[model samples]
Target: MSSPRPLNRRHFLRTTSAAAATGYFVGSSSLTRGQESPNERPVFATIGLRNQGWSITSKSTKFADFAAFADVDANVLGENLEKLEKQTGKKADGYSDYRKVLERDDIDAVMIATPDHWHTKISVEAMLAGKDVYCEKPLTLTIDEGKLIERVVKQTGRVFQVGTMQRTESDQRFLKAIALIRDGRIGEIVKVTCGINGATGSPVIPAIDVPEGLDWDKWLGPAAKVPYRALPQMREGYGGGVPLYTNCHYAWRNWYEYSGGQMNDWGAHHVDIATWALGASDSGPNKITPVSYSLPVEYENGYPTVDDQYNSPTKFEIHANMPGDIPLVITSEGDNGILFEGTKGRFFVNRGKLTGKPVEDLESNPLPEGAVEAVYGGPVSENHTANFVAAMASREQPISDVWSHNRMLEICHLANIAIRLGRELNWDPTKREIVGDEQANAFLSRECRKGYEIDM
Candidate 1:
């Protein structure tokens, strides 16, 4: 086998600059003469071609062709295939198993938007197979998985971009707020509050026969095999069936078995901003202590039922100690937003707006010369998908590369672990292990079903 390629920073800069000078947009069809061959576009396969996968395909088609698509749910896979054919005017092969997609030699990269439990496994395997990966966040379901992915990226030498799109959107309130904080207009960040809406609960319907096209067994890959149930109602197009009486699919976030509920779901986005502004993307909190927690006893109208059925923390006040003197408290509340308190003033940001005291601070302060550039490597691109394509072509790290993303993911996972354990736990980042507590350490990794190991 050939030796892997090194992703050197200087080399990336040089190539990017040269490409920019030549007016050749990275990954553009017009740039076919730059590398590979004029007749060929980089071929990519997408796993979990359901909800987010379709969006990724729409974005990627501007740069590359969809060579294949994979999803355990045949209904979703077939629907996406038709869409891809219509949009790209290319007939793409379909697969019920992602492993089969990875085995092909023609594919250059793989975009993974699978469930939380499957992210690390498929991403690591794809990287080991010499394909670059575009993986969704939170990058890993567990702390150990994050560490393992970080190691795999280093070992494989393949470019890996985490789908933290907020990092690329200049108009996003959260990203703009961080830029203001890093500019020192907000002063030293003393506190942070992050809120998530709610959690998913059990379904009311009973289990039913599996759908026709779906490979039910494959859908449960790695996850323990359970009886077939209608996909969760929250899932797009979920209708007409005896619901499994348990939340599944998109609602899986509410369950501990499949995801980390709102904590990991929305926390991944908000906490990422907190880490980015505090300049703690490489390390994590020293301690995570839950000050308060509340779970819903019933579901809202049109919302799924609420019960201990879901393992994720629905409501909690988690105080985390960062490197600074002040501690950051991440809380879940009715309103979803992120508030940052600093020495000079306070700033609050959410999906819709960014606001703070002494508003002029934001207008006057510009990001530090190298800080913003270091994170994104250049002027902010309007499009997140375009940024990933550019990074792939220039061989540079994307704004949300695997290493930085895994660090943020570690924070979310640790917060969940602490909440589940219902106690304070010490963390040792250097060792990548939970210090001194065997019981807590057990939560770091999960056992897969028979024949479904992560290939550690």
Candidate 2:
């Protein structure tokens, strides 16, 4: 592995001289780069130390040295530090505030595993700090945040990899599927079903006192301040208990305030594959209609009528019409996977299996040489985080770049908005506008808490 360009005080000053104009470090560091000893590897920080954050940090130690850890919940920060230190034989510093971790010059990169809302804030700041980033899936909570991230990436020229690890893992099933579709093995593609099953919401529970050692205000961050609710604040573990319905942590996906439910939860992966097969990563749907939907609670314009219960759509079938003749269906009714149906044949794929006539034909006739490699943009790695570390050294774009993911996420956001409004809406991709419906258009962005506004 290539060593990161170590920044001394002078180098940090030089690289950050343009911070005022660009909002982040723009100049290149002058430190030499070469192989570093095992303990001297590039330093990386973990910003959110809960579920997905813990998983990513644990796996990333093989690629980068741990430098700092941050989380709003002090309990998580303390526990994870001991576990990581015991494994690596070195103490990785811990912090409750993420901005403090970003302020350090020696830190080379950061992995952002915060909730959907905090993804944009930490990612933008990390790039500005001249640090490469690995952010969890559903890159943004809203469509406008996606636009902001795309612009910041272009300005900073930092390496970024979304946590859609299916590209690097999955034993090439999704890649092969994309290659088959692109190579015309599926004939003329007419329709697709990206099935991401949904779930119900937490019930109307009374607010409880903030848990001991947790920073409730910082945990809310850009989200609105509500009385602390235990079920939505933490998961089954870490002083939280299981509820009759879904709870937080794993079930944060069930809430609209913190996430996009199943739409962004699983759609970040499958919808991306659907977009890839159609060669539409840089484009999006021309129109969207909510054929059917069932939210956990009543909604006005788009806000939930009640705060005590989960409110995101729990069951939905959204129709997205593309520039091409094909129409994409997103639903919670089918097996959890993606189905590509063309005039000639159809195939199904998920994490466990890939099936249908197309896959069966692979026995007699296979994808040509380098077909899978072509789809992956190059040689595939053993896992996804390795791909990100490789891109940091090569200074090349990872397989899942922000621009394409942003485009795919736009589709997911539109579907969610369509479901929320209970109406069909027209979209102009070129102009990035929702045609004719001002109320639907207003759903594209949101009101961030005043102090936490996206400055970019």
Top candidate (TM-score): 2
Superposed model 2: Cα runs more than 4 Å off: 1-40, 231-248
User: Over the stretch 1-456, how does candidate 2's per-residue lDDT look in tens digits?
Assistant: 122222232332232222212322111121223333322456789998877788888998876678899998888899899989988888988999898888887787899998898899989988887788899999999888888887787777777888988876788889889888877888999999999997776667677777788787787788888876544443455424433333244555677778998999999999999988888887888998899999888888878888877778889999999768689999989799999998889999999999999889989999899888777755666577766665664455566778788889888899888888888889998878799999998888888887886545
Best by lDDT: 2
TM-score of each: 0.86, 0.89
lDDT of 2: 0.78
**Structure candidate 2, residue pairs in collision:** none
Q: 1-456, model 1: which lDDT tens digit per residue?
A: 112233454455455545444444433222323444434456789998766778877888876778899998878889889999998788999998798988887787899998788898999999887688898777777788887887887787666878877776636556567667766766777888887666545534355677678676776678888775553443325422323344455556666667787888788888887788788887877777778865444333212253335545667888888876457677876568778888889877877777766445545754556555454445555466655655666656666777667777777777777777667878776676778889888888888888888765
Please estimate how well model 1 matches the true structure, expressed as its whole-model Cα lDDT: 0.71
lDDT accuracy of residue 151 in candidate 2: 77
